[model samples]
Target: MHSQYKSRQGHTTLGNTKTTVAAPSWISDFKEITKMRLSISVVFSSLVGYLLGVDVIDFKILGLLALGGYFMVGASNGFNQIIEKDLDALMERTKNRPVPSGRMSVNTAFIISSIFTVLGIIILYSINKQTAMFGAISIFLYTCAYTPLKTKTPLAVFVGAIPGAIPFMLGWVAATDDFGIEPGTLFALQFFWQFPHFWAIGWFLYEDYKKAGFFMLPTGKQDKGTAVQTIMYTIWTILISIIPVFGFTGTLQLSIVAAILVFAVGIWMLYYAIRLFKLMSVKAARQLMIVSVSYITLVQIIYVVDKFIR
Candidate 1:
């Protein structure tokens, strides 16, 4: 639900035109508005960071972190839809969202988001001040900065990556209650990974995006420059992912064995990136997108497993 769907006036889910073929129920609408699954994935990233930083798990902290992270991301998504309801209405993939499709009022969405913002901050504050600060900043940067920049410039991806990258490091801060090279390393890994992941998504949806005036590609089109940057970022992502093996990342240590495993996935992702560069087709981009998800998820799992066994 990073940047999702649009509207068709005078409709209640069109069945999601019902992608259920039956108008989405209120329960379904709630899920759609909050972008529930996407929010959960982001929460999982924060938990992974917490695991890397903590020597012993604290269930209280873990539960709080998950709740706070979900509220924060869900709120961001809700506000994003409110702002882009019209733009979302213009895209086929987004047209069924509640706000733009007349299933919910804008004011209602705003209230829910505002409540989430307050509740998310409070929950994070219960953990520690540093965690709370980062949570607020993530929300502000996403909704205030990144959300608006989507249609203004392709560099919106750069801006968006800021909030997108925070959950990983935020968990570290929650665990260690410190900001240092350890969390910085985690942030850098996620930060660079987003470029290729998001770009591939942009490539395949370039046409749909243009309908809403979105400039997702670096050059604003499917071209050599975009492909080259994809490869470049993929390389950067690989470099950062393996850096923990050097043992300079403090608490965020990666064993040589784990680093090898991480490198293998990075190369796997890189191959797809190169294919995208050579082929420059939507199909190639789609393949890269799928591999990138696996690459990131696998590398993180390796880090967490290495942390426990090493």
Candidate 2:
């Protein structure tokens, strides 16, 4: 009888241990739902904008801007997941997301998203009304327009780029509290950069995206047309990035050296893009995607560094 009791106790202990080990913490779930890494990248772009616009860097405002940007982007991502929960389950890449995987309830996710949205806007408002307005607009467009349009048409990439490009410009708004040629130039640079960056993603993830009825490429297929379009947009992105060096971007002028470096980075991106066009292979597309990310990151870094040095 004692032996039987001991065995039952052991079984109960093991069961409890397994249950405890399997349950994820609230923080982990929050991070997953918010797409933390993506949110951080968005915040980084906003920070770059703020740095470029401000002659005097206020760490307090900078911190608030980063926090605000993160919350807004987090809210957008959370709402997107909630809206696309069913579609997410169909795609292997998104199947394990918190909402679709049954780890988070829709009602709970919605509430969290709402809280973040309010918090984000309030924080941005602390910076300035224009900054807050742009943040709110970004959230609205991303959640309402971009999220829903994904499954309906490939034009979703174009719609999505609007909100994506806003972050960089939003920072300038936060700093200057005005939308002018400087912020507009920043917006144009990021606006055109999205094409090659996202099309490469679309090309490589064609199978996964198709599983969920998302067509992100312009031609709706991994064809030479899409590759050619990617090349064209890359050229546009390169051209726009160097416009500041020509003394046409108001107060946001890049030095000749900075422009040269930026052009070289653009060439690097274009080289990979051309390779993708020639090879028309998934591997080449993946390479372009990587180079595209590096290109933008390097360009932003060079711009900021040039501002300080010259």
Candidate 3:
């Protein structure tokens, strides 16, 4: 009987040991740390630029551009997290992030970020010198300048928009190795789009941002002034988005039909921005945010489709 009990005890102990040895979920943790969804969205913008610029659509170059864009954005995000870990811990939305939540050490995060930065620059460099240079600049501006500036002043949004706009133009540069009116137009579209999108986020997350002392909204409050600025920038975004149809953007020309479609979408976005100005409520801001995202995505789709159809 005692021998039988010893065998059962051994089995239970083995089961306990097996249960205690949990496997590391490095992939999921890495995704959270790098903000994979946001990185993917940025990569999509670069791919859109590449698709618009490339004549023959080389899948190999396209793949490299997407990969390089993701790595660069990922590295920027990781570095941003490391620098803002303490501040992030104070914010409800960011408190659960890998660095702030103690799921990942800063040293490990830094090492991973370094690897991503090196790989990203090399991948972009393989495409072209200009692409690599812009990739590096995007990372530098995002991590070094925009990340810290969030707490200092609302103007960080403008600074942040520089790197934010780079991906859209980077694809064009990757394809042509040139920065001309075409890429400039792409940069301008994205640069203006960020204001409304970011301000909408700032409006709704005012309290959360306040927890960490981040002054994201213009006027540093969700007042009529901020809403008015959001409206003004939305108008600017709409105006510039249709300028390609006027034939000034060279190879980046848009058909009149595409221009009309883009304008319609812009109008839809503007309606929400106007409503936000009138209502000045969180709901209106949220609606504006959703419409703004749809507007950009639809505009990009229209641009690419217009290219192929034409």
Candidate lDDT (C-alpha), each = 0.92, 0.91, 0.92
Instruction: Encode model 2's per-residue lDDT on 84-162: one tens digit a residue.
Output: 9999999888887778978679999999999999999999999999999999999999999999998888899999999
- Give all TM-scores, in the order shown: 0.93, 0.93, 0.94
Question: Which stretches in model 2 have alpha-carbon errors above 4 Å?
Answer: 1-25
* True-vs-predicted CA distance for residue 34, candidate 2, Å: 0.9
Residue 151, candidate 2: C-alpha displacement in angstroms: 1.3
With a 3 Å backbone cut-off (N, CA, C), the pairs that clash in candidate 1 are 5-94, 6-88, 6-89, 6-94, 6-95, 7-89, 14-17, 14-18, 15-18, 18-21
Q: Candidate 1 residues 1-310, lDDT tens each?
A: 2122223223455433445323445556778788998899899999999999998999999999999999999999999999999999999988888898877899999999999999999999999999999999999999999999999999999999999999999999999899999999999999999999999999999999999999999999999999999999999999999998897888678899999999999999999999999999999999999999889899989999999999
In candidate 2, the residue pairs with backbone N, CA or C atoms under 3 Å apart (3 or more residues apart, or in different chains) clash, namely: none
- Model 3 residue pairs with clashes: none
Give the clash total for candidate 2. Answer: 0
Worst 10 residues of 1 by lDDT: 1-10
